[model samples]
Target: MNDVVNLAEKLAQFSEHWSPRVVAELNDYQLKVVKLQNSFVWHKHDDTDELFLVLQGAMSIRLRDGDVSLQAGELYVVPRGVEHQPYAEDECHVLLIEPRGVVNTGDAEDTRLRADNDRWI
Candidate 1:
């Protein structure tokens, strides 16, 4: 059976920053929603590319070459094996798509910021 997912309402259920909530699943990939603020650690995914879509506010992905800023409704794809860090000055809503079991902090582990997988909203 299939069901519709309301992103906004789903987002309303959680408020912790940097912690992503599983909203939906598509095959092997999981669609997760997160609220970002401040800075994230520099890390790289060795196996899979990650898609970051800004649902609201603003965000920037800092790479070795340059930093890419994304506003509401914008999106960016961080290719696999590329080290990058994400930051936001204010509350930013984001939707991330990556294969199931992908760690939130990538190769860099931050016990304070690491979120458990398969947590549904």
Candidate 2:
């Protein structure tokens, strides 16, 4: 069986904003897909690095040090234990890379936990 996935097709399967879906896994890491708009809570993953890749639309990562903007075809990594928030003016599709068990809202838990690691595709 083929282990690879078509990113475009995977993204097309969901339309929920801020909810993440699992696309693939590697060792202890996972590849997740999420649609974002508006602002996310400020938080940090104390033990894992977070990666964001813009698949469609635009957004920005607000960090304690500064903010980074991303357009389609762009990507950025938020190192472990860094305080940051993600925001988007309009609908945006993105991919996240992080170790398994990493929560979407980091340590600050709330209603934002749309799906857990096990629910990912």
Candidate 3:
């Protein structure tokens, strides 16, 4: 547990966009690093809030009412049951913090954008 987990180093281990690689855990939550490009499916975790922290580049979380923009060193939390879709025009590195089993696509029926849970780098 003493080993340091460098976000940039772990982020470099994979190149697949929208797929998150687990890096660390705190209690029942998991810290994941994901590369994002283009747009993602609209989904929501009915049981848990999802956190998105921008490590590099920028992204936007589009809600039905509006949108939330995030740049490097910024973070946003999508409250539980809030319908939202994430999008990026270019390669964006993000740190996601959510419950261990919370699906990336949440309750959305579109399985194509659903990523494998608990995958580690």
Best lDDT among the predictions, by candidate number: 3
lDDT of 3 by residue, 45-121 (tens): 88998999999999999999999999999999999999999999999999999989888988889899788888988
Better of 2 and 3 by TM-score: 3
Tens digit per residue, CA lDDT, model 1, 33-90? 9999999999999999999999999999999999999999999999999999999999
lDDT of predicted model 2: 0.86
TM-score of candidate 2 versus the correct structure, residues matched by position: 0.90
Question: Model 2 RMSD to the real structure?
Answer: 1.6
Q: Tell me the TM-score of model 3.
A: 0.98
The best candidate by TM-score is 3
Task: Report the candidate with higher lDDT, 1 versus 2.
Answer: 1
| Native-to-model Cα distance after best TM-score fit, residue 56 in candidate 1, in Å | 0.6
Q: What would you estimate as the lDDT of candidate 1?
A: 0.93
True-structure RMSD for candidate 3: 0.6
Q: Rank the candidates by lDDT, best first.
A: 3, 1, 2
